[model samples]
Target: MIRSAYSHPVAEVEITELSAVPLNVVELLSKAHHPKAGAVVLFSGEVRNNNNGKEVAYLDYEAHQIMAAKMIRTILDDANKKWPLNIAIAQHRTGKVTVGETAVVVITASAHRSEAYQANQYIIDRIKHEALIWKCEYFTDGSHQWGGNCSCH
Candidate 1:
């Protein structure tokens, strides 16, 4: 959505069509890189084996896909406003995600390291806080819990 040519050297909002397919962090990182950019920061969120004290079997993610994409774009826009980023991308997965599989990936590119790193973190944090995506964790012992309802902080 950033109209400025300099603001958006590369920008994308992606929601995986095949839930079984893993997030490709390398591809996102490559897309974020630009000749003018000195720094490219990437973040990948993966499904862990355990949450709290429970042993997680797999994660089920759900979202109003259209709304989630909109929210992600908005978060990217906010990052653009706060930083001098040349490129930004944020992606998330839906349906079942098993342990060790990537659930989300975010990338940011800028002329400086500070802005790239800061904006990358900001984008992911905002997505977690504001995006409509929800996750349900299925434990190995036949227990389940809503992930969005809980926060680390």
Candidate 2:
């Protein structure tokens, strides 16, 4: 079953969500802000107009809702262990997402830009590589293919 938003209290991570609706960048960024943070990095993974030379119509994402949310929390926790982050938040969409729309977002705030940037990248990379999410790419010709979110596997 598709789940809306899921969030639970973690020691370092504030939010881990697998949402069915569109992600709000401004709201997430605001939540990542901290008095001690000197930098907050945001990564929005948008659905592009084309992929592998095919004209894309849109994307449909599916995930093992509970498993995916737990995986994201684990990823955030790992990032927290590796960086001195004040806050971290991750949200991923799990439904029809049109071209140019955000499919996933990761925000990290730290006392330095270096840490924030590193942690943000780490979180997204791990999610793309490890999350239990699947993506089906719809082409303009009405063909589609289901696969993992990344090419790592």
Candidate 3:
């Protein structure tokens, strides 16, 4: 269940989304375009080939969909309140994702680069810590481990 606390008119696109398909950065960026926005920032988190000295094979992501979506929306709403943003979107991928594939994308637009950059980072950081999402990493050595999306631990 996506939720927003903003009093302004909402954007045409959903603020937060959890998808099973690969994220399309181009499409998302296009949606963020605004005539008043002088700056647009995009952050894409991709699956790497190695982690903790292990040759990573791929990753499988799972989330409590309703709760995760809600958390992401809240993060975006908080960011909007803190920054003069034109548009903000956060999208996460679910299920198996191969190396080099994007797992999450955050886009933010504003009248200036600083606010856009800061808000983009803030939204992503909060989502990492607050969203109810988990990731399982598969290694080439036939081993696997599961952990929360947050890297803080």
What are the models' TM-scores? 0.86, 0.89, 0.91
lDDT of 1 by residue, 78-122 (tens): 888889888887788888999998898888888999999999999
lDDT of 2 by residue, 17-81 (tens): 78899888788777777788889899999998888788989999999999998898888878777
Estimate every model's Cα lDDT from 0 to 1: 0.78, 0.82, 0.85
lDDT accuracy of residue 96 in candidate 3? 97
- Candidate 3 structure quality by residue, lDDT tens digits, 7-117: 654355654479999998898888988888899999999999998788989999999999898788778888888987888899999999999999999998888999999
Q: After superposition, how far is residue 33 of candidate 3 from its true place, in Å?
A: 0.3
lDDT of model 2 at position 93: 95
Q: Which of the predicted structures, 1 or 3, would earn the higher TM-score when compared with the native? A: 3
Better of 2 and 3 by lDDT: 3
Q: What overall lDDT, based on C-alpha atoms, would model 2 receive against the true structure?
A: 0.82
Q: How large an RMSD does model 2 have? A: 4.7
Weakest 10 consecutive residues of candidate 2 by summed lDDT: 1-10
